[model samples]
Target: MSEFSISDIGLKVGLEIHQQLATNKKLFCNCKPIESEEYSIKFQRKLRAVKSELGEYDPAVLFEKLKSKTIVYYANSESSCLVEQDEEPPHNLDNDAKDLALVIATSLHSKIFNEIYPMRKTVIDGSNTTGFQRTMLISQGGQIEVDGEKVGIQSICLEEDAAKLLGDKGNIREYSLDRLGVPLLEIALDPVEGDSKKIKKIALSLGRLLRSTKKVTRGIGSIRQDVNVSVKDGGGVVEVKGVQQLDQLEKVVEFEAKRQFGLVKIAEKLRNSDFEGISKRENIFDITENWKSCKSKIIQKALKDNSIIKAIKIENFSGMFGYTPFEGIRLGKEIGQLVKFYGIGGVFHSDELPNYGIEEDDILIVRNILKVNQNDAFLIIAAPSSKIDFAINSIINRLEEAKKGVPAETRLATQTGETVFLRPRPGASRMYPETDIPPISITNQELENATKNIPKSWDESLLELQKKYELNSQLSEQIFDSRYIELFEKIVGKIKVNPTFVASILCSTITNLERNGLNSKLLTEENIVKSFQLLAEGKIAKESIEIIYESIMSGKSQTIDEALRNASIETIDEVKVEEIIVDVIEKNQEIVKNQKERSIGPLMGIVMKELRGKVSGEIVNNLLLKNIKKKLGNI
Candidate 1:
């Protein structure tokens, strides 16, 4: 319940969504576009920011180049090839990917290009092997209805996905080649109303449209969104990257809007107030000796590691540090964003003083040395001696940016729905035509075929599923939202099973398994189809669906038959189930007589041990109850 109004800030928002295509091969190579744990090959290289033909360098790329990072790539023969290693030239663009993009563009009422050409967009973040990403604009000028308002589609581009980030272990950045060269579509939209709720709904609608075509991959990293938000009087637009979760998209946009608004207020106050010595700060102080008796583990650890601790004093910035324009976000936390760039834990400021084992006397000592006034605030940070200067300057830079209100930059999203500075936003100088990829002339026949065979809208498909499968809205939405909606339809159409039962196994059982920490994504579509086929053929009981799915996901068994055998779900008849329950009831006659129906729990446990996955528990419970009533003469 945020009371903040979008109109108050004069905010405007835009979205750039990139979704991976469900193609069998990589966009530029014959290798499969799937991740593999078995990496038999590795290589390391250093990326540099090269100037475009006009001799212009990208600021963001220059920043990454300054880091002097070493990037390591892992690849296997089956999952990758030289195309991703930057040692070989790329092949032709993927046809299936083109068809999918064409279909999507047509569905969005876009005008497809008769000829498409690829251009190389410069990147030096170690996310691309060739120092650039190959992108081709396929269509332009379309619209999609969101909340009864027409949201304009700017451009649809087909591009190769970047390398999968493995980890950034210090100076060496690791990436997997498996995700590189994977074909994905980037849909750029014009700025819309600044409403956060409306923006989230628009994103959800776009995702549904893409998924309904059944041409996009489904997973955590399969899609990513870049949100650009800005307020008219605040500052330039800032781009927030790596927003994968739709549920958090609203918060991400809202946070940026508030951040921009806060910065504007800060700049206005600084301009009008009598505050002096903000830009005239001379040097950072060496305050390590003042904290010799400090008990904070973080400070002690830094001392133990021989790291340098420094402090900087700013006048007339006391309350600004704790001024929260958004929930859970304070101006002090804003400065901490720069602190993180130096790879430090966080910054200690006067706004949150008298804690962290740093006493009031400790603050007084530092203040006396820096000669701070009542309106002044100071920052304390610990870093290696070699990086102390850089850390100090990082703080100075952020304070300077605050004076201008919301510097234009690219930021990374945190799990808490907050954004932190990643780097300066790149400009148009980052792109140059890819000479290796010649312009492709698309024919009228191509568009005609794509237009004639458009995929059904996801909303229409969901309605059909609701009617034919008798699935509740929740279950049907999950199935439609997933890539397995078509598969679910296929199973229900061919198998002799209730659609509700199938939907439960697909939706509820898989969700239950995921809640317990099992990765249900590991369950292959083929395995699911086979499991339902087994149920259709009566080779396995309906109760075995969870067991079968769990076994498949856990790699215990590759197929339903193997899963059945591994779980010891041998062929057992109703008569045998009745006999087993009869024996249990007789053996527990005294307990059954005493507890009556309450004995069902212990009796069901005893029966499930030998008959789990072999027969339905509902049937076992019914027979156990019938026989127990007869034995106890309670019925």
Candidate 2:
């Protein structure tokens, strides 16, 4: 990677960030914003692509339509409704969601638009019930500074999220509509002037700024990133999708840059070398019936199912097929991407053959069948006879594009931060006006209010929380970042207990509870507010918050009072605490004499365990220390 400079290669990278806004209701409906997959109703649908507003159809959507997939949509009464089913017209624009997007646009210094029109982005992959996602541009021409350099913000859009893909079997794909109508804030960053490393920094800086508002959802799948990378001599921009981690940003860009560079080199080599059979039908051939008794499981399965095998021979493309365009990714890996996108299982090329249980005898036959020399390579894929056209066309298209250079396509980010082909990069042909909903008009006063409503940047928020609530720096930052600051502030304002206590519960205790497999989402803010109200009334001990919360989350109690009853907690006043410590030390007097100060810790643990959640640990510690000294003096 150090061998080439990014500038010399003309690497231009842009980032598109999609974050689910923390809103009470779905963007276009009144349904609750739930994330769970459990649902009572499941229905199926089939959709096809049509021409876009420009009268140009999206090839990518057409590809999905060709697969003839069966889409199963899951819904529930609470989080999904007619709006998700497309049976009812969408409700009015969610002002709260729009306001949240405006707040982010304001913070990023974007140009607020007076009018916003929702457009339908063609997506027939069964991720949306309507066959297209509704997206509207809210602002443009913003900028954020990363490492003292300006990273231009191109545009900010508010869109409804797609359904979550649960699983897929053959042509049947499972989806859940619970996440379908959730509001998503999409921010597209302008192509920055830097290498892959600078791209990572720019993405992280922007993400932090968005998160600083504390109105964005924080968790896995709540935020997503799409990167568009292209090199100078490369064919076109390749969009890499679903990069969830900031750490993966650099790797994605690096691998893509390297990939384009290699593809360009291969193209140049093909242009100069003995590129032969120049426009001949001899490239793709049938070697199906020749391989009857292959030992490969993939081959065996296909043969058992009476499938056909197709092979494409690329003249002057032997070593190039196996060449590592990027670390851990070969040019052949690009072919594997096509197989997956086209719904086929696998593909084999001569470069990787004599392996995968294909004998050299089989290889010699292929070479003879295609009349290919040692310098030539052949690719093969097996599928049902019905799938032959799609598989063969995919291979032919990829090879023709490779000869021209890197093909413009959309890619999926892998676990290793690398990319695999997803589909051809859809162009302006994908978007059309959504006519059902009228355009939204924004007023100057509305924009001003949104700007004012913007929360403090993360750094400032941490300092303010620490000073006002006397919270530790770590706890204050966690409160801001966990999307808990709003509820914490509300509780502290209305209740009389220490603000630090609320912060501790919201920032630390609840987080720990979730890690312990307690569904903290089940324990709503109302639950916490009421529980704190109980604490203020001296009806429950602070130590019992965890126990009470566990009961509430586990469905043991629906109400705070009921949870407290199940907890069986008592105030255990200092007077009773002292008596308990006195009795405990008296019972363990011999141990106290032998260990003295060390005996205090063990005795406190024993006493606290016996009366857990009844009294504060601070009270227990103070009383136990005093008792331990008195008992030792008597000894």
Candidate 3:
């Protein structure tokens, strides 16, 4: 939906996907990777920007330090240790995780390094309990085909996952250590041609390939894709982090492309303009009486709380502050970023005349106080002294960058498909060897064995399933590519349940349960196998399987018969149902005789209430019809 053409936009996209490996132990320590409910440990710490060897600090680090961010971490002894909490040294790497990464790398045709060296990537964010993340390169320089065109692969790294961030208060961010130190396999790709459609195919192909290994963790938060996008028209590289769904990939790229393109246009227009190099003014003004009659409830409440409304003058920039390159975002968003980073409330600008009830007289007073000409823009923020200063300085810095074209940065994605600043892109200085974990070597024999054990290609498996099972291409492909494929085939081949029913329950029913907040993981593969076996043996009706699944998801661990006995309705014999229908008709004989067809409705409702969940509704309806006809004939 952007104004720019796909080709003229010149978008280049690459992906860095991280998936949790299904290992029994943590990547650095012997802690189990399973979920824990115990509360055993808690600690608080703060991260400071460390100067790189180049004698310079990362811009993002400097930016965060200005906001004074602190972190609080929570841990459980059952699933974490002092190593995860950064209170002690980490142990050697887990070999199972290493082997899994090697298998995946081999499948992608990547050439392994003779020796794998672990590196410490600097992450000052609170997501990592440790200030730095431990990572090691496994392989590099592979390729995959998208529509018969090769997209180059960059490198694959084995890293330890970060802790989960809980929430953030004024200066402190809370985190949970349950997911800390989980083994993560990070696969990077070379920049592909800026085709959004092709980028989508590449992502889907890579995801399916990873799932084919059958050793990666599944479900929400188990996998994440980070995209690095840039344009050839001099826009800086933008990193879009934590993209969870494949469907949103194209839209994200399109938005980024247009955003960069607009920034470039703005920079071109600002060339040789008098507003160049205008520094931010550090002065703060108390405009309480000026906005006394303001219509904005937000500003009025701020006044009541004794919060000051401060405005900064930017010369020669009228009519530009309200310019929007994307929906729901303005140049004002950059100012808002500072407000959030420093824990401020909100801000106002001069480009758009909001219905704030500022009379003509008050506007003249503000202009005279700031000495601003008609060609200038003023930024006004309502907050305490320190936060107001931080907000103004941040706005000036962003405006300066706008003159230089799009600034290269890393941003976080919101659920609404918008992006916010996370940090500046780190340079090569962030990469340093991780001294705790030793280098690992992959032998030739190991690669050969992994290749030999490679599962059948998804396409080949789909074709074989279609011919053998007499199914359509869509159903066959769905079965072949599903994580539940192995269990589905076992159920249909060993048990006597219909293949279609088994497939639908495994794929569709589980998806529906997950969407409805039920833990589909609780209904394990073994649970499905057992439930289908019971259905095949006539111990439960097919309709009752949904009840069994719901019961298990709700923490009931009984067998099919036990589950049924606990929740199912008692089955009424057909003769008993017929007798009940006849009794109901006799009781309503007056209505049955006068309106022969209408009496069946009340009789059917009564019979169904007694036989609910025990017998088919069709059988009840048929028996009700026969008894109603006989009663009317007698009358």
Cα shift from native, residue 484, model 3 (Å): 5.1
lDDT on C-alpha atoms for all candidate structures: 0.84, 0.82, 0.75
Return the top candidate by TM-score.
1
**Residues 1-635, model 1: lDDT tens digits:** 13466688888899999999998888888889867888999999899889988899987887677566899999988888888998899998889989889999999999998999899999988899898999999999999997688999999999999999999866789999989999989999999875788899899999999988877898788888999888877667899999998877888988788778777877777767555544524647888888777777888999998988888888778877877655655668877776676567788999998888888888888889889899788888988876777667767876777777778889998877878889888999999899998999888899998899688887787887788778888888988876557777888888888888887777778878887878876788788888888777877777788888888788777777788778877658889888888888878888898899889989999998878888878888899888888887853
TM-score of each: 0.86, 0.80, 0.82
Off by over 4 Å in 2: 1-11, 35-40, 195-218, 248-280, 403-405, 444-459, 487-635
The number of residue pairs in model 3 that clash at the backbone is 2
lDDT, candidate 2, 1-635, per-residue tens: 22566678888899999999988789999898876757988888999889876677888887787788989999988899999998898898899899999999998899988999988898989999999899999999979888778888899999999898899888899999889989999999998657877887777677777777777887668888999988887887899999987767788888788778878877776667665532336576766788886677788888888888877777877776677644554668777778776678878988888898888888887788888887888887888877777777877677777768888888989868778888887878988888899999999988889878877765786687789989888877767656566788889889999987888888778778777878876787788999889888877778889898889877788777788788787776788778878998888888899999888778878988877888878878888888888887877
Candidates 1 and 3 compared: the better one by lDDT is 1
The clash count for each model shown is 0, 0, 2
Query: What is the C-alpha lDDT profile of model 3 across 1-635, one tens digit per residue?
Result: 13667688677888988999888689989998667555667788888878777777767667666766778888888888888988789988888888888888877888888788888877877778777889989999888776788877799999999888789887789888989899999999999865777788888788777776767776667888898988776468999997877667777777677667776666766665677655554334567777777767777788887777876777887766677655544566665664666677756778765436555665666677788898887777787655666667666777888777778888776665567777677788777777766777778887777678666555765677778767778777666656677677778888877787787787777777767777776776777888778666655556567777877776674455556777764555689878877877778788788778887787677776666556657777898888787777777
How far off is residue 353 in model 1, in Å? 3.0
User: Which of the numbered candidates is closest to the native, going by highest lDDT?
Assistant: 1
Provide the lowest-lDDT 10-residue window in model 1.
274-283
**lDDT for position 347 in model 3:** 68
